[model samples]
Target: MEAPLVAALGALIAVVEACGAAVVVVGALSGGPARRARS
Candidate 1:
């Protein structure tokens, strides 16, 4: 009972961390192009 709940919470935390990393990576990649365009 409690074990399953703990596992679910862990998975959710992992997913959120992954998504945050992905967003940071995408933002970094796109920012380079925008900077070039500005120059």
Candidate 2:
């Protein structure tokens, strides 16, 4: 319930969301072509 703790928690959530988004984008980009090749 402190300001610094709240700020840090928000920052951590943002970082996690960003990393997850990047991973999804990269996976989709790589999978699209490879999936087509196999099919």
Candidate 3:
């Protein structure tokens, strides 16, 4: 019982980290073009 709960929590953490990384990558890609256009 407890083991299953711990596994689920670990999986959730991994998903959150992946999502954060994706957001960072997208922001960096989009921000570069916008900055260049302004300059």
- Root-mean-square deviation per candidate: 1.0, 1.1, 0.7
Candidate 3 residue lDDT tens string, 1-39:
899999999999999999999999999999999999999
Error of 2 at 8 (Å): 0.3
Q: Candidate 1 — which residues are off by over 4 angstroms?
A: none
What tens digits encode model 2's per-residue C-alpha lDDT throughout 1-39? 699999999999999999999999999999999999999
Q: Estimate each model's TM-score.
A: 0.86, 0.92, 0.88
Best by TM-score: 2
Error of 3 at 36 (Å): 1.5
Colliding pairs, model 3: none
Clashing pairs in 2: none
Q: What ranges in model 3 sit over 4 Å off?
A: none
Query: Which residue pairs clash in candidate 1?
Result: none
Q: Tell me the spans in candidate 2 whose CA falls farther than 4 Å from its real position.
A: none
